[model samples]
Structure formats: C-alpha cells, structure tokens
Target: MSGKTRIALVTGGSGGIGRVVATRLAADGMTVVVHYAGNPAPAEEVAKEIAGAGGSAVTLQADVTEPERVRELFDAVEQQFGGVDVVVNTAGVMILKPVTELDVDDLDRMLRLNVRGAFLVSQEAARRLRAGGALINFATTVRKLALPTYAGYAASKAAVEALTPILAKELRGRDVTVNAVAPGPTATPFFFKGKPQEVIDQMSKAAPLERLGEPADAAEAVAFLAGPARWVNGQTVFVNGGVI
Candidate 1:
C-alpha cells in the first residue's frame, strides 16, 4: 500500500458517539474523514479538533442512503488520502414506538437510513477498502433486550446484525473484516434527550456495571476493531456494560 498513512471514513461523524469514534481513530494514528449528512459545521469542528490535537482529519458530506453520494464520498477519500483503510458506519436514526403504535412512515425513514444506509456503506467498503481494512457498522443492544417502544429502532439494527457476518463471508479473501458495534444506553445528549430523570436513573442502574455506557467506551471498542482486532470478524460486539 505504498506506506501511505491509513485513512478512516466515519459516517455521521458529527453526532454524539460518532464524533468520539472519529477522534479516537484519529488519535490512533489514522487520517480521519468526518462524514456528515446534513450539517457541515459540526463535522468541520470535529476535523479541526482532531487537527488541533496534532492528528490529521478532514470533513466530508454524504447521505449514506444515496448511492451516488456514497460513491462520490469514497472517490473523494481515495483521491485525497490514497485509499480508505477503515469505515465506521455510524450514521443512523432511532424512532422509538411500540410495534402497534409505530407509524409506518417513521419506520420507513428509520429503515432507509439505518438499514439501507448501512448496506450502501458496506457495499462500497467491500468494493474499495484496502486489504487490511475493516468496516464497522452500528447496531444497538436494544435488539437483544427487546425493550418496549424500541420496536422500530431495534428491528432496523437487527437487520444490521444479520448482514454483518454475511458481508464478512462475502469478503472472504479480501481480508476486510465486517463487524457491527452494538452500544447500550450511553451517556450522550441523544440518550438523555426527552427522558425523565427517573427513567434515566433506572436505565443507568439496569446494567450490572450500575452505570450507563460512555461515548468513549463505545469508541474504545471501535478503535480495537478498526486497528488490532483483526481476528474479530462477522460479529456484533456489545459495548453496553453488560446491559443484556
């Protein structure tokens, strides 16, 4: 690979956990590409933060659900950084509603981003990633817990889990490990939004660890998979503090 610096493209890099993952990878010595969907400000801030910390990073925008945009994203990365060595598909949305109450439109929107977006990213990664690269997708621990009102979100992430190992097998000789990181309740603004204090407290204590997962905790797992956990393939690593 010409001894070029490894590059990592993190989708939704502007969001809570996504921001942390991007910085963590950059700190791990990879040139980071912070990909955002709608807003560039946050993404640019993340890139600048990484650069300020003496790491290399840049911002890119792409709607993961769109094929052409995703392709262009890869093209830009390849042209600028040589080639992508890691892709963390953290771009996803969660719409909480019980099965009976879930609006079909909301379900469709979530599926479009969470499932289809993941597929598009995985497809491109399979086609373009360097031999030693790894593709990490996002899943959720709710898929295993089967919590109420999370039916739609859980279903979407469940699909992600299903495709993970299959993608890994399909990439057999390519040497690109395909895996998903499933995070439990994490201490992110997204997690705390609109939830009551009592509810948050109960969730915080639900895990045997007696606390909510941190963004850095999830970031650590991603760093492991992105760099040294080459032997871990086609599996969903739960970073939820034993929450299931």
Candidate 2:
C-alpha cells in the first residue's frame, strides 16, 4: 500500500502451475513472494530465475494449513513490501479414487490441503491485501466433468468453488476480487504422478484442444484475473481446453 510496485504472494510456488503464475506476475512488474510448504528448492530456483530475468522476486516457505503461518505470510509481505496487492493460492493435494474404493485418509488429505489450506490463505488475503487486490484459488474442471475416479478430490475442490462467490460478496465495495481457476489435465508433476501414460493420453484427447494444458495456459488466466480483470469477481474460470 506504500510502494509503487505491486506485490503478489503465490502459495505453492514450488509446483508447476504456481511457479508459472509467480513468474508471470513478476514479469508484469509485480513483486512476487514465492511460497512453498515442504519443498524449498523449486521455489528458490523460480525466484532466482525471476531475478535473473530482471524481475523482482522472493521465496518464502509457509504451511498454508496453519493459520499462524498464513498470517505471518501476509505479515512478511506487508513488512517487507509495504503491502500485498494479489494473493494466489495454488497449494493443494489431489487423491483420486472411486467412492467404493476411496480411502478416508485420502479424502482427509484432500480436504486438509485443498479446502482448508485454500481457505486459510484466502482468509489472510482478504484481511491484508490492499484495495484493488485479487485473491485467486485453484479448483479443478474435473468437478464439472463428473469423472468417476475423482469422487473424493472433486468433492474437496467443490468446496473451493462454492466459497469463491461468498468471499467475493463479503469483500464487496473493498475493491478486492475473489475467484478460482479450474485447470483440467495440466501437464504438471502433480497431475502425472500415479497415472499411466495411456490414461493421460485419453484424458488429453477428451479436451477439444486434444492436448494436456501447459502451466502457462493456466497462468495466463491467473495473470488476467490478478490484474486488469477487476470487473470479474466471485467466479471460477475454467482453464480446461474446452473440456467443460
């Protein structure tokens, strides 16, 4: 709020989609804080790359599931950069299985990171971000596809989609926008893990684009929502390649 440079804090910045979002925002002249949970190496590399490219960036580690840590995350941004302008919550866990074979532990993990972690990061963003700030949360297009194996994971993301509008409304007149990005079949480590190549190919063909989404594809949407899309709020923009 005190500096001319806009500040953006991207959670899960060590990962595929998150890292791209952080990098893109920094390229747009926003000071980006790359947040990681357990992994620091990737976050560090991303930050280094940004600085090398003449963009401003800093890497921070925080467990978004912890309220104190989430609060401190915002505090660090405010303390160092004067204030935060955009908060992108890309931290989440995905566990896929049909309802009949789903493990409760997997479901719990999904809710903990995908739902609870997102809420915590978004909550802090709402409290600390200056006017014109934007809060972007990650959702999944699988929810609309109604994919059978994603029962547990989709349910968790469903909660995230459901929260966007309410949070946006609560911030009414504050000039803060709250929204979600639902990416489908992205070519990220998080998506490739545990899946066979054949399944991946099939899903890719499911999209009219006939390919898995690249991290940049999703980041482009985030960049727009994070900045000039001020009139767009309380909505979930699907980043799938015409799948849903």
Candidate 3:
C-alpha cells in the first residue's frame, strides 16, 4: 500500500468493548475514527485518551442503522484520511428475555442495531475499504451456548455470524478480510446491568478460564483480525475463553 497511515473506523467506540478496540487499534498505529450513536462525550474521551498516548484518533457520530448516516460516517473519515483500511463494527445492543416473555419492542431494538446496523456498516466497508483492509464485526458466544433469556440477543448476533463469512467472500480479490469476534460474558458495565450478584457469579465462572472476559480480551482478538491474521477470514473467532 501507499505510505499513508491506515485508517480504522470503530462503531460504538464510546463505551464497552468498542472503546478498548478503538484504543487498541490506535496503539497499533492505525488512525482511529471513534463512532458513537447518540452521546459524543464518551467518544470524545476515548479520542482524548488515544491522543494522549500519542496515537491518532477522532470522534464521529452517526446512527449506524441509517444508511445515510453510516455513509456519512465513512465519508467524513475518508475525506479526512484519504481512505479507510480497517472497519470494526462494534455498534450493537443486547436485550435479554425468554422467547415466551420476549417483548417485541425489545427484540426489534436489538435486531435493528445488531443486525441492521451491522449490515449498513458492512455494506459501506465492503464497498469502500482499501485493499488489505479488514472488517471485524461483533457477535456473542451466547449464540452457541444457547443460554436462557438470551434468545432475542442471540438471534440478532446469529445474523451477524451468518453474514461475516459471506461478506468475506464477496470481497474476494480486494485483500480485505471479514470476521466476527464473539465475546462471552464480558465484564462491561452493560453486561452487569440488571443482573443479580448470583447470576453474575455463575457466568463469571462458566468459562474454563474461570472469569468473565475483560474488554481488552476481546480487543486482542480484534487486533489480530485487524492486523496480522491474514489467512483468518470469514470466521467468527470466539473470545469467550472456551465457554462453549
């Protein structure tokens, strides 16, 4: 490629695992675009942290589910950086409920962000990313574990898993790899929300590693797909410490 620095757009980079992934990519020397849906404060903070560490990063806002907004997000990045080389789609939501108790509104919310948002972003990445680029999407290990109260979330992530490999093949000859990172029971604030202590304890120890995943754990996997894992394409790399 040219001597220009690589550019990476990380959706939902304002918080949770997305924040760490943005930070990690910046540290690895890619110019990071931190994309947030609503709030810009957290996204700004992430950019500041990366800047302080001598890494290049800028914050951008977009409703990822909206095609126009997603295109704008990439447009801004490309206009400023010349072109994007890595696109990490970490923008998504999770709503836990048994199928019988499922609230249709909650399911729609999850699907809209998790599946539709993922598709819009992936579509842009597939069309625009530079050669040798990579697009890493987020999934959840619960899809395979088949846990209770996760039907809505799992179904949405299942769509993410399903689309990953297909997108990789579609990008054939472009040298850009498409993959998903399925994190299991990560200890983000969102993960602990609405869960009791007992339930948290149980999940923390479910993995053979005997603890919940940290955002950094998942970030490491994304880093691999974003950078050195050249042959690893169209696959969901489970970052759950073997929970399944």
Instruction: Give the top-scoring candidate (TM-score).
Output: 3
Which lDDT value does model 3 have at 194? 90
Q: How much is 8 displaced in model 2, in angstroms?
A: 0.3
Question: Against the unseen true structure, what C-alpha lDDT does each candidate score?
Answer: 0.93, 0.91, 0.93
**Stronger candidate by lDDT (1 vs 2):** 1
Off by over 4 Å in 1: 1-3
What clash pairs does model 1 have?
Answer: none
Question: Comparing candidate 2 with candidate 3, which one achieves the higher lDDT?
Answer: 3
Pick out the ten consecutive residues of candidate 3 with the lowest summed lDDT.
1-10
Ranking by TM-score: 3, 1, 2
What TM-score does prediction 2 earn? 0.97
For residues 47-134, write the lDDT of model 3, one tens digit per residue: 9999999999999999999999988988999899899999999988887778999989999999999999999999999999998899
Q: Candidate 1's C-alpha lDDT?
A: 0.93
Q: Which candidate would rank higher by TM-score, 1 or 3?
A: 3
For candidate 1, report its TM-score. 0.97
